[model samples]
Every structure is written in structure tokens, then in C-alpha cells.
Target: LSTVHIESDNANNTLIAIGGDNVYLTFTPEEPLLLDSIVVTIAGLATTLTESNGSYTATLTLTGSEPDGILEFTIDFKDRAGNPGIQVTATTDESYVNHDIYPPEIEIISITSNNSDSTWAKVGDSVFVTFTASETLDNISITIAGVSSSYNELSVAKYQGYHVMDDSNDEGDIPFLITYTDLGGAIGPDADTTTNNTNVQFDKTVPEFSLTRMATNNVYGDSLAGIGSVDTLSFTISENQRDLNVELAGSQKTPEQEELNFITTHTFSESD
Candidate 1:
């Protein structure tokens, strides 16, 4: 002649406590429990709670890398003078999430003022962007100086909680137009949502360049010691290429056609 009952302190992931304290309730010495057990299930990362006498509680802290989800758990108490009965099976859930500080890389993957459509990202106008990239994404986004060009593109990626952008063009320096996208979704999307201005200032400085030689002649600066009128000396210096990338020139009917931007451009000859 007895009844059982159970209760949960937290319906979500929590530091569970009970009765001015906590109780991982159990039974012993005959008088079986109506509900004799409880299964503590949790998601994300959980640590066992320390027990004090019959009072205790536990904590489950979420990790920065924990994914979004839920953890279901059950509690069982037996029917006794203490009403060790599962009046209503106690239930709870734990949720996990990935806090990102940076947004996804809006790597102008493939942009061209070509068709009227521009993937929505306008040229001069600024706008916010968003994405769920994992962990707190803070710093991510590349600038093209508000200057538009075929060589410019946005690249967003997670190198180490950092949304990295490689605005590398084959040739010429593109004015850097930066729009920081941080902890929202992707890189730019996130930054757009949180920032006051969408697109900021542009890198106005035009890159410098010089002509070097790359040939097979030998007499002058050719790699071969003595084959042609070219010197056996090389004339290529490892350009700082810090912000430069390698690009191939596109074909055009006229020499005035737009030249593809690239970092390195070599000339061939046998002159002194």
C-alpha cells in the first residue's frame, strides 16, 4: 500500500539540485520501489555531480564545439512512506549549440558585373550578412576598396576560430573595401547584421610593379651558363607578393582589352 513520485529540477541542461540541496534518490531493504531506477542521459559534455550525504547536484557545461541538439533523460523513484513513487516520470532535456564569432567567407566565389543579377551583394551599397559557421566567429571578411573588379573575391573560412579571407588577385592591387563579418552565421553575413556600416573604406593604394626576365637564352642572363646572347644571371626577385596572386591574362580581340590582374609578369629576351 504505497505510491511513487519523481520530479526534475531542470527541464533543460542545468545544475540539478533537490530539496534545499540535491538527491540522487534510491532505495534499499525490501519494500521495493514502484519506479526503482533513473537513467540520466545528457548531450554535449556532462560531468557527474558530487554527492553530499543524500544531497547532491551535478553540472553539464557545453563545449565551444558542441553541436546544436537535445539530450533526453529519465528519473525513477519507488513507492514508499517517502512516496517513492514515480507520480509522473521526471523528464528533462539538454541542448547544445556552437557559438561562432565569425561569419562565412563571402568569397566572391564567382562574381561578375556580367548579368544584371549580382547574387544580391551590390557594388557600392553596403548590407549585412549572416550564417551559422560554428564557435564564436569574430574576425572574417575581405575588402576590395569598394572598388569592383573581376579579380576581386571574398573568401571566408575557419582557420582557428578565425574566418580567413584571401583577396589574392593575379595582378594589380585592388583597393581594399572591407566589411567585417563576425559571429553570426558565415563571415560577412554575420558582420553585416551586427555592424553599423555594411561596407567600409577601400584600400586606395594601387600596387606597384616591375618587369623581370624569364628565358632559356644562355649568353646574357639565361639560366644556362653559355648558350645564347643572354647573361646566365637570373633577373627575378621574389616580389613581396604579400597581397598579390598569380593570374592568367584573358584573350581579347584588341590589346586594349581588359588585362587580367596577376602578381607576376615576366619578359623574355637577349639584351645587355
Candidate 2:
């Protein structure tokens, strides 16, 4: 070998480069030195050398499909003086220094009913809910209660649909669940919650009621004189509870009065 100037030897120097190139080694002995071999083993590839020059250099090209990490290899040499020595097996890291992290993710913060068109058919046609992450999401699997659904879309915000999970229309906000996973298999740190773009949410609360007379709904039998009604009823319901039936005690209210009794039954919900 010419000279073992690899700092670890009689010399100390740092030599590093990208791609394929030659690595230098220096040596000097009393007689002409004949070299042996330089071997390289990368994560996914291998190369070798059989002969050498007394004071020459060897080149190795690191390329293709190699895993991202350090690659180790060895260089062995023998001189005419029967001096046998091997360079410490060396390694270099394969790094994607510029690998990009995705943008902030629109975690299924929440989805909700804007109106009649609300959540998913499986999820009690109500509100959709989800969250947003500070990082991007390459893929995410969303399940409700226990049912799994695939949700792999990119957005700064998301409107997740509620999956009813079963055939039960029992009105309650129902159990809400969400999981956001990134491509690297990292989960966000935030305790996920929902937000409302329209600031409107589905209401699921213990409803209240009140009563007042819609009118002095006088009942008069076709008589010579108009008769006065004794029963006066008053009641109140939520505007959301529309199309619900309201009735008075033991009075067959008809037509117009009956229609007012049927009020809508919708709850109000809020999230941010």
C-alpha cells in the first residue's frame, strides 16, 4: 500500500463527499508495497476489489435503493514486507436531509348538520366532527364506536361524518370518536375536538316545554249565540323541535289549532 494517511493511521484528516468518488490512503515503507483489497458493503448493495497499487487510491460509488442510514465496509491491505493491516470497517450515512414534513393536517375535527343535510347515513344524520393537526396527514383511518372507515384526503380543514354504526335512531348526540394518524404513523398530540364553520351544531339536550294560549280558541256549536270556551292551554317548544305534536287536555282541537301542535323536534349543539 502507498501510505495509510487515513487520520486514524499516521495521518488524521476528514474526507467526506456525496455520490461516487475516490477515497485516498497514503503509505511509505522501505521496499515496494503491493496492496490487497478494499471491500464495501452498503445497506442493500455490495462491491469488492482484489488487487492494489503500492500508493494508489480506490473509488466506490454509493448508489440506488439503499436504506436511509449508515453503511459499513472494510478495506484490507498487505504490503511486500508482509505487513498485514486492515482499515477499520468504515460507514457513511445515507440521508434525505431535505425530506419534507407534510403541511398542517385537517384532522377530522368534526362534522355537523348545516341543515337537513347533516351527518352520514350510518351516523345518525346529524353533525360531522373532526380536528386539524399542526402537521400534514398522508393517510388516516377513522372509526366510530368501533366501525372502521378509510379517510385519506388532504385538507387544511375537514368535515367528518358521523357513522351511525347501527340501526338505532335514539336521539342523543351519540358517542363521538376520532383518530388522526400521519403517514409516518405518528398521532397528533392534541386531545382531538370538533369545530363549527357555520357556528351551528346539532342540539342534543333534555328538551323543555312551556304553554300559553295560541288564541282564545273559542268553541261555538252552531247556536243562536256564540259560546265561550273554558279550556285555555299554553305551551312552548324549541324552534328546532318543529313538526311535533302539541295537544290540550281532553279537547279535540282541529284544523288550524292542531297544525300548531305539531312542532319540529331538532336539538341545538355548539362546538369550536
Candidate 3:
């Protein structure tokens, strides 16, 4: 007699988390032959099987609070001819992990700051990034603008990180890659990908504004220093400023008073 196939539903060939349950073992013979009995050994427990219908089926139940380790299954059968067939055995590759495997779930919610919601941060400004995970991850990292940085766990399932933009960070949508591993060592599909996918923005320079107090300054060209009839005041802005308005103390100035036919506010816009 020759053994055809042997397996346990819980066995994944490498690791099996039986968790002290009844593992149904099935053994098929290469050809139909009279089988008197079958002895099966799982781990250290042994049992005899008598159920057969062209094959043999046995239920092996494990118990106790034993630590997870290597699992080996050995089967020995006797033919009706009172002859013993070849012994068949199957063991896990290394050790059996008898614990539930729950892959980690990670997501990047938002990367923004209190000053701006457009995901824009100036140099030396900390960009706060919010993250959520289903479970406590074993490893968590963030890759922004081609640079990778580790993260610190804050609470149970919430995590955040601060990424400071420097002169190296140009004006563009910075790609953010979050890689994480769960307690079971399971990672996402595109975990290590460095493509420009998820992203934030970085502004290297702060907006610069210059005021040219242009008024009827006599021949000396020293315009009225204080609150003079500020008629036709020339303004110069280094960069573009959005929602910009010229305010005096608390009141916002109208376009007529803030601008003239020759000069206006200098505004610039940049996108990544």
C-alpha cells in the first residue's frame, strides 16, 4: 500500500494555528486496499483511526495552554493483509503560530498645519500628519520628499508625525509614503512603493512685503512719516499673497484707496 495524500485543514504547509481545536486529518491511499487501523501522532498526542471510505479520517484534538511551536503529524496504517505500509508524516516548516493573524490597516488622513489647510508649510515649520491604524503596528515609517522618517505612537490606535521642511524642499506637492507592519508581520501590497502618490506641499520662502510710503514728500523726497494724506501710496510685494487686503488698524481699505492706475499689490502664485 502507498499513501496518496495527507493534510489537515488548519495546516497551511508552513504554519498552523490549531488553537486547541479538532483538526480533521484525511489520508488517501494510492489504490484501494483493506485498512485495519491507522495510528496518527500530532505534536505529542496520539490517536487511532478506524473510519475509512476509500480513505481514512481522524479527528485530533489539542488542549492546554501550550506555547506555539513546531507541529508534526505522523500516520501509520495496517492493511487487512496484516502488513504495515510505509509511514507518512507532515510537519510545519518552522513552528506553528497558534495565534490569530490580523493584518495591520494603515491610512494617512491628512497632512496640514494650523496656519494653512492647503497642506502647505514654510521652511522650519512642522507639518503635522495624522494617521490611523487598526492595531498597534510593529513598525511604522513615513517617507516624504524622498526622505524616510520613523513615527512615534501616541495613543492606542492613533499616530502622528512632524516633518520639518527645509531649503531642500522645493515648491511642489511632496509625495508621502507610509509603510507599516502589523504584529503578525503582515504588510500592505504597495508598502515600499516610492512613487509620487500621496503628497503634501512645502514652501521654502516666506512671503516678503515692502511698503514704499509714497506721498507728496516735498523736494527732500522724505514723505510724510506719520498719518499724512496717504494719496497714491506705492506698494511692493515680493511674492503672491492670496486673500490679500490692505488694512489700516482694523478697517480694510477699498480697492480705490489701496490701488492706483500705475501701481498695485504684487501677488504671486506657485503650485507643485
Candidate 4:
């Protein structure tokens, strides 16, 4: 008996489900083979092989439960001289059939930005996105503000990419969506963005503010004041400012009071 060669009607690495799939095997005999003396078993399922066109061929339907890996098969036959022959090894040339029933599980690790403050982004800012999967994947992409971009593989099961902010983006909080396919030909669940996960905001308008001296203060803008006088200044801003600092007479002062209307006040006592 010669080496048995295995082939499948389904393509190599083709994902097999619970249903039946056909596999064919062929082998050469050293002498004339006996009729009804050929048997082939694959994954614990047995089938008979018949001689056809100078070759022994058999078709087996893989309907039984098999492990989630390469399929192994064995062949047994007898010659016309009553010599029994058994071949337990076969070559598939790496053309393997895989069985996988579970789909890929995907998770978005982070969606961030490279701006000075990760919470906000400007027109020239770059937003970074990262994700992971249960297995290696293909056709991976991330959609942000209606724009789609592909991801680069950083390592096995990890991917990273970035998108630059442009004028086409809206001036508000933006959401993201991700899609990918695993090696088992399963489509992963779409990762939808939420307020708690995504925090980048696009703001283009410059914040405005107006400064006014308190009416009860002894000093006003362009007004003469005596030595050692105390003055209070109020600032009304268009929006809330973080780390706001005010410099008066070469001294830095923080806001004494911050209000919902975006108003901040500072009091200072001057000398000399």
C-alpha cells in the first residue's frame, strides 16, 4: 500500500459547523485490491472505499461531533492475494479543515487623543484608538464622526490606530464604532461608543472674557489710587476655564469665587 492522500470538497481552513461536510480520500494499491475490502475512518466515522479509474476513492460525510482542529483519518484494505494492509498515516499537504463553533470576542480597550488635554481636541489634533480580540482578526476598522479608518496590528490580538481631526468634524462630543472579523470567519460584535468611554470634544471657537472692577473698590481702571489700597476685580467669561490665572502687579492670583454663569472674582491689596 502507498501513502494515502486526503482532500476535501471544502476549501482548506474552511470553518465547519455542526452540519455535514464531504471529504474525499485517494490511495494507490501495490497489487489488485479485493472487492468490498477497503475501509476509511476519519474522526471516528468509517466509510467504504471503491476502486475507480485505477485509484481507490471514498467520500465521507463529517456529520459526527469532532474536535475543533485538524481532522485525522486512517485507511484499511486487503489485496487480491489475501494480504491485509493498514495505513494509519496520511498527508494533507497542510490543506487542513478546521472546526470552530465559537465566535470571536472583541473589546475596545481605549479611545483617546494626543492633544495637550486628552478630553478635548482641536482641528489639528490626533485621536488614538485601541482594541483587542480573542484571536487574530482581519478587516478591522474604527469609525469616528462618520469617518472610517483602519487599524494597525501592534501585536497578537492587539491593534492601534489614530485619526486626525479636521474641519469636517463637528464641534462637540464625538462617538466611535468598531468592526472586525476573526480567523474563524466570524464577525465580531460592533463596539459602540458611550459617554463614559469616549471623552474627546472638538472646540474651535476661542473663549472670551470681560474684566471689570468692583464698584465698591477704591481703585478702578485708569483711576488714581492711594498707597496700600485694596481692590476687587471680577471676570465674566463665555465658558468655564481650567487652571485660570490672573497677573496683577507681577503677582499671580487665582479666582476667589467661581459661579455657574462663568464669573470669577479676585481681591488684591496693593502696596507702594
Candidate 5:
């Protein structure tokens, strides 16, 4: 019978790599006839002949001097009956050269408060971090404090969002580790273990306070006052206070100067 058809495992040209990469070629004939010998020409160079199991298997270790892009090759073989099969020649689809042997570049752009652009925030204030990379990433993640965040593929290298700064965050250089895999899945030395330090000033201290007396239409800020038609007590805080409340002590003086007191509470409005 005449040799009908021939095929290769490396067909469709999807299996690609750099010059130093490995290539495994297995030729399949139309029938299970034993192959006399198989010769493969890659980059215009012929390989040594070898055959097994009615098919041809040749493992080629490409040299660094091989061409970078498309790998052009041809296969010529004959049956054990000494009948020449067919002359097969084909080229691989365009493939990228593995020139990027180094790791991807990672950088911390800024760490800002979620409510504002301030790097310093109160303990309960929400915060976020922004970062970037030099190349497209297959996966990227951040670990802050003792918490690890989920990673996602980045359409662009730069990434930012809620990266785990919350009310539970403590004050200090929040030690964070950034791990990533490049689009080509190349991880350099310490690339997956790279870390960054962000110093976040978390204010947990309460504001200092002072008492002032504001009489009816009184302009002078004073702490003590005498009898007046109307009296108002004012409290001053060192910082912009939120949800402030004041407790007042009501007192009545007897003829013997003995005082009877009662406790009253006052809350401030938002405008105050």
C-alpha cells in the first residue's frame, strides 16, 4: 500500500519557546507500518535519524544561536519496506522570544486615606494603597500586617484600591509583602517574596479640652463669670472634635455657702 498521510505533534505551531527551549517531535503515519528512518530539518539543519513504534520521536534542544521567531522545519521519512512516504514541510506561527529573563519591576506609588488624600489618619479612618509594575501581570497580591488579600490579573500594570487598611490597622510601618507572577510566569529571585513598608501615622490619642464661658452676646473668651441675664458654657477642643458631648454640673448655694448639685448632659449640633 502507498503512504497516505503524515502529521506531527508540534503542528498548529502553538507550542513555542526561545532558542534554548526544548522541542519534542512525534511523527504519526497513516498506518502502523514501521519507519525506516526519520530526518527532521530545523532552521535549515538536518538532525540525526532515529525511529520507534511505527512513529518517529526526536527531542531537540535548540541552541542559543537558533533564530528567534518562527521555527521552520521539514520532515522526510520512509517505511520499513523501503518506500518513501511524503515530503512534509511547515513553519510555526509567530512566537515571542524569551528575552525577558529578569524579574518584573514593582513599585509603591502612594498610600492614601480612603476619605481624603492624607497619609496620616485616625485609627478608624479607612485607607488604601496604590502600586504599579513594569510589565503585564498574570497574578498580583498584597499582604499587610497579618492579612493576605486575593489577587487578580491586571489588564494594566498599575493597581490600586482597598488594600487592607482598616480600623483594625495598627500604627507603624505596616509591613506588607507583594507577590506576583508575570504574564510569562517568570519569577525572579525574591520576586514572590518581595515586601514594602508603608509608614502610617495612626492617631489614637484623644483631643485635649478646655472650658470657656460664653455669656449672652459675650465676645471675650473666659472660663469664669458672674451672674448674668443668660449664661452659656462653651467647650474648646484642641482638634476638630466629632460627636462631642458635654456634662454640666448644676449647683445651688445655701446661706451657709453649702452647695447642692445635679448633673445635666448637653450635646453639640453638627454645625458646632
Candidate 6:
């Protein structure tokens, strides 16, 4: 007996067989064989060969519950004179079948922006994203703020990518989506826009503030000239701010107190 080829319905002309696919084994006999005298077995499953175009073929369907490993085939047949012969062969080229049964599981590690000081993303800023997977993947892509971009593989299980912010993107909390394909050609989950777990705030408007004089003294029209004279100034900001600082006469000073709507006051005194 001579083995012609071994393949599967998913990939033709290859020994590797994907899970849940039918594996076909074809062989040709050295001498003409009698009908109903050929028996074939693969992976311990017995099958009968049918003559087709001068060659005999046997098919075995995998239910995806088979262990992931190499497969072997056994052929037993009898010639026209009833001479029995047996042939055994293994999958060639160190190939395996049914190795990949489960799809890759992916998780988002982090989604950040170039602005390290804040989580707010602005126009022209680069938004970075990183993730991990249970298995190696390919054709990775990430979508952020309606922009889709490809990712780079940093390692077998880690990937990173970035997208530049633009004016077309919407403001407020922004969510991202990730799509990938595992080594088994399994497509990952669709773009998830409803999850807020990896959200980043996007803001384009700049904060504004105003300074006003709250007190006047006779020593100077709008400023303090000498010792014992004091002038109070009020600082009003459009939004709440943290670590606010004020520069007065080449010196830095912190607000005495902060009030509602981001209003702060400071009293300055001049000395000779």
C-alpha cells in the first residue's frame, strides 16, 4: 500500500486539520485490490475505503473533543489473490491536527494619552493603548473615538497601538474597541462601544480666568506704594483647578482659600 495524501476540509494539501473538520486520507494500492477488502483506521476510528478514480479514500470527522496531537493512519487490505497486507504511517512534516480548539481571550491593559499630567485628551495628542491576550494573535487593530488604527506586537501575548486625536472626535468620556484574530483564524469580539471600563475624557476647550481688584487705598490709585497699605484681589476661574499658583512682585503665593465656582482671594501688602 502507498499513501497518496492526507488533508482536511479546512486546509487542503496539508496534514494539519482544524478542529471540527473532516479529515480525508487517500491511498493507492501497488496491485489491484478486491472490493470490500480494504479497511482504514485513523486516530483509532475505523473506516472503510471507497474506490474513486483508481484511488481509495477514507474520511474521519472530528468532533473537536479529540486530544490535540499528531494523528496516525492504519491501512489493511487484501490483493486479488487474497494476500493480506498492512501499512501504517503517521502525519508527515511534524504537523498536528485539532491543536487549536479555543479562541484567544483578550483583555485591555490600559488606555492613555500623551498628556501624562492629566487624563484629558486634547486635539493633536497621541492616545496610546495596550492589551494582553491568552494566546498569540495577528491582524490586531484598535478603535478610539471613532478612529481605527492597527496595533504592533510587543511580545507573543502583548500588543500596543496609538491614535492621534483630531477635531472630528467627540468630546466627553471616550471609549475604545479592540479587534484581533487568533492563530487559529478565529475572529475576536466585535467593537465594544458600550463599556466604560477603558474610557478617557476628551476636552478641547481651554480654561479661562479673570483677575479683579476688590479694594482701593489712598496711598496709590490701583496699587499699594508703602508699608501698612493692603489691597485685596479676587481670582475667578472658569473651572475648578488644582495646584493653582499666583505670582506677585516676583514671588509665588498660594490662595488663602477657595470658594464655589473656583473663586479665590489674596491680600497683598507692600513694605519699604
Sequence-dependent TM-score of model 1: 0.26
TM-score of each model, paired residue for residue: 0.26, 0.36, 0.48, 0.74, 0.51, 0.75
lDDT of 2: 0.39
TM-score head-to-head 3 vs 5, winner:
5
The Cα local distance difference test for each model comes to: 0.30, 0.39, 0.55, 0.66, 0.50, 0.67
lDDT tens string, model 1, 111-139?
Answer: 12211332222233332223233333344
Model 3, span 47-166: residue lDDT tens = 546555676765666563433444456777666675777777752222233433345676435666544644566777666566777767656777666666556678887777666777
* Residue 271 displacement (Å), model 5: 20
Model 5: per-residue Cα lDDT over 1-272, one tens digit each? 22222222322222444334555445567665444456777656665545565556555566646664455667776667877766766423322223233456775445556435364666556545566777665456666544675544334887653444555766655455666666545452233222354445556566775554443433453343333323344445566444444444343212111122112323333322
lDDT of 2 by residue, 178-199 (tens): 5554433434443334545322
- Candidate 5 lowest-lDDT run of ten: 253-262
- Location of the lowest summed lDDT over 10 successive residues in candidate 1: 248-257
Off by over 4 Å in 6: 1-4, 11-20, 28-35, 46-56, 68-73, 79-81, 138-141, 190-199, 211-220, 242-245, 257-272
Tens-digit lDDT track for model 4 on 145-178? Answer: 6688656889999887678889988888867788
| Candidate achieving the largest lDDT | 6
Alpha carbon lDDT at 228, candidate 4: 49
Model 3: residues with Cα > 4 Å off, grouped in runs? 1-96, 99-102, 114-118, 191-200, 209-213, 217-230, 242-272
Error of 3 at 96 (Å): 9.3
Better of 1 and 4 by lDDT: 4
For every candidate structure, what is the RMSD over all alpha carbons to the true structure, in angstroms? 16.6, 14.6, 12.8, 4.2, 10.6, 4.0
Clashes of 4: 0
**Model 2 stretches with alpha carbons more than 4 Å out:** 1-108, 114-126, 145-170, 195-240, 243-272
